[model samples]
Target: MSNLPLTSNKLLSTLSSSDYERLLPHLETTDLPLGQTLYEPNQPLNYAYFPLNAVISLVNILEGGQMVDATMIGNEGMVGVPLVLGTMQIPMSAVTQIAGQALRIEASIFRSTLQGNGALYSLMLRYVQVLMGQIAQNLACIRLHSAQERCCYLLAMMQDRVGSPELIITQEALSRVVGVRRAGVNEIVNTLGRAGLIGHQRGKITILDRAGLEAAGCQCYRTLRAEYGRLSRP
Candidate 1:
């Protein structure tokens, strides 16, 4: 898996071979545990992490202490965007949403290397744009969609990030991410379960009806995919 194309990630893979090789030496493989905070709100970022299999969530904590995931990053993208934007501090908190591995690079090193006209810098910029589109769509979804629709969208997004039908998460944690109460989440979960769209046991959720889930989601999911496709540019 380590030897598989670093380009498996659209951002890294889009780089020219020579450019990728130059940065390859700096990429260090590391394990990411579930719920691990990569960066706290308003904190300085130390490194940029490119997931090989991990999923990271960018969450916003409101003044009232309410939390919701603004966007998600996975093997298709990288974390620590502040590094590329010429800042060390992040406004939102980043945390590992799933247990997996990633390629990490020091912020200083990445910034220095990315300077000047280079494929790496271009790829990073495009990825950031794609990420912004996802966040914007999610913001709208949360405002206009039903809790059940948002729940389906969230699960579909998670499945895409992890490339698995089963997700290991709890109602309490999910409530925080979806910006809903525990009871609301439980009610939706129970509805989906009874309809045979999903199966939940303990903290694990298994998607049983992919078609049904897609039907249940708002336009946000498709919007996210379209934006990524536009930025990825094959």
Candidate 2:
């Protein structure tokens, strides 16, 4: 019970006992390391991952090799959403942002199970809506908000997902996600550090004042939270 990977995930936990039992045999526990590429742009998805403790990023890589995160999936959601809709290809990159374990299922099995499982299908549909809202909010945030505000927004989101004050990620990766230069990210981090909102160390950041960080972010952060909360309700 305690060692079961899917048991702790919000999405999997909501499944009916019988449905979970049917899929349990197909679930394989796997470790996702930091910076691991789950899927590349326009590539076939071999499996669907339901992360138990990992965080995955959906990033859009530009022609210039720059990347910007479109959305994030964790214990609350499943990756390889295209498999459910009869498509195995995605234009964005799916990468492991946090090293942890997940229940990886064959794409074919997941798709077949989802087709006959009303509860699972409906839950995934709701998650898709919530994810769309987050992506839209992120677009607006990037276009209208300052770098500092965006940094705060990212930190607040990471804190919510990981349920921890300490996040282990590099400034280079942070810059890519926020669509900014490394120097720009450094400046924002320095500002947050000086304001006592966060403490920075090599390859890690510790949130010192979550409330203050949220206060520094734009309304997009709150809007995204409300949308996800509404869709996630049982």
Candidate 3:
């Protein structure tokens, strides 16, 4: 109901005027704090969130209760896609990995608007495609890349999504996201810091040199980035 600019969320900003107007009344702006659980596995989703600056991580829980990152959703896409697709449940857990804000809409209203098969539906489908692509690429990267390379890849991806060089995340969180041990994460962080690619202090990571980080990362980083750019273009 807020007439605030939708420009922060690219997915919403791309909606045609008519489609945007239809969904505008139902939209409410909200903040997403770090560690906020948007939804749990197999639970009904109550709302669909279009992130303005927040980054949500979709994680798969292993049998032993370890959480491995599946993919991350930022301003380029929406959370709660299961609701839009007519299913209220998702197998993975959704959490706010970064503290920021977003625009949200009730699940039922979002579903009805999506059922119209208009621009929102089409755009969301494209977003899903990109999401799937990134997940698949991550799978391969995890399998074939070294821990250091994977760390660089994750940092690069997060930098692009958040549109900032400085990230306020703990090493433990980075380890979980990269599916590596904390020791390994520390090693990678130290390596990057020594190379002048990044500065790490406390829980913050500042990208001192973007080009250097990209060069240290695996090819999957560039590949997924190019795919996202190509698929998500208006």
Candidate 4:
């Protein structure tokens, strides 16, 4: 597991022994269903999730009801980060993109645990910094990169998080992640499949060649991975 955390979540693993011990009692193991919205725009958060295998996306909803993923959170990080920073509400929605396990804690209790300027507090602050950098890169990729390149980057990231070559993701989810239409997603995935980078059929996508997938993706995927690598290092 990542950094030998009690759970697979690297953020939990990176916490100091005392810090981990203090929160262990309150952390509950839960299963997140795919497409479940953890929190919505301006909605008060109740629990923070430290995903062990589950992948969550922080999606920003536009005025016309279009949704774009700001960034994806996996075992590398936690949802409900704003609570630790004294903000109770967020403009984006945190939705579960993959169904898997997570260690969940009540937001109030979690906030109380970070009362002082301690190791956990410092660690989360750094994690937030890494997350911000990742979101920035993702936004840039969406604007400057092709749909095929962005799709490759997103699939590669999701595969890394779930530790599986095969992914159970819907065309709807693909459209949301790539900020494209359903027809566009079909076109992009078809191209990737034809090139042998990935095999997409219905709701499941199988990575046929990991190296080839990365080769097809833009540099943003590698950049995000490097940024997350720095988070666990702290």
* TM-score rank order: 4, 3, 2, 1
**Cα-based TM-score, every candidate:** 0.91, 0.91, 0.93, 0.93
Question: What is candidate 2's lDDT per residue for 52-116, written digit by digit as tens?
Answer: 87789998899899787887877777898888668989999999887677889998888888888
Q: Over the stretch 1-234, how does candidate 3's per-residue lDDT look in tens digits?
A: 233357678777777688888888889889888899999999989999988877899988889998988988887788997875679999999998877788999898889888874778888888888888888998998999998998998898888767689988889989988888999899989999999999999989999999999999999888987876665465
lDDT of 1 by residue, 1-234 (tens): 344345556667667778888998999888888889999999888899998777898988898987777878887789988888889999899988877778899988999998953677877888888888778777787889988998898888778766789888878877866778999999999999999999999888999999899898787777877777776463
Q: What lDDT is reached at residue 64 by model 1?
A: 93
lDDT digits (tens) for residues 101-147 of candidate 4: 78889999889888853788888899889888988888798889999
Cα lDDT, all candidates: 0.83, 0.84, 0.85, 0.86
- The local lDDT score (0 to 100) that residue 185 gets in candidate 1 is 92
Supply candidate 4's per-residue lDDT for 165: 93
User: What's the CA error at residue 66 for candidate 3, in Å?
Assistant: 1.6
Tell me how far the alpha carbon of residue 106 in candidate 4 is from the true structure, in angstroms, after superposition.
0.4
Clashes of each: 1, 0, 0, 0
| Model 3 TM-score, 2 decimals | 0.93
Best candidate, TM-score-wise?
4
List the pairs of residues colliding in candidate 3: none
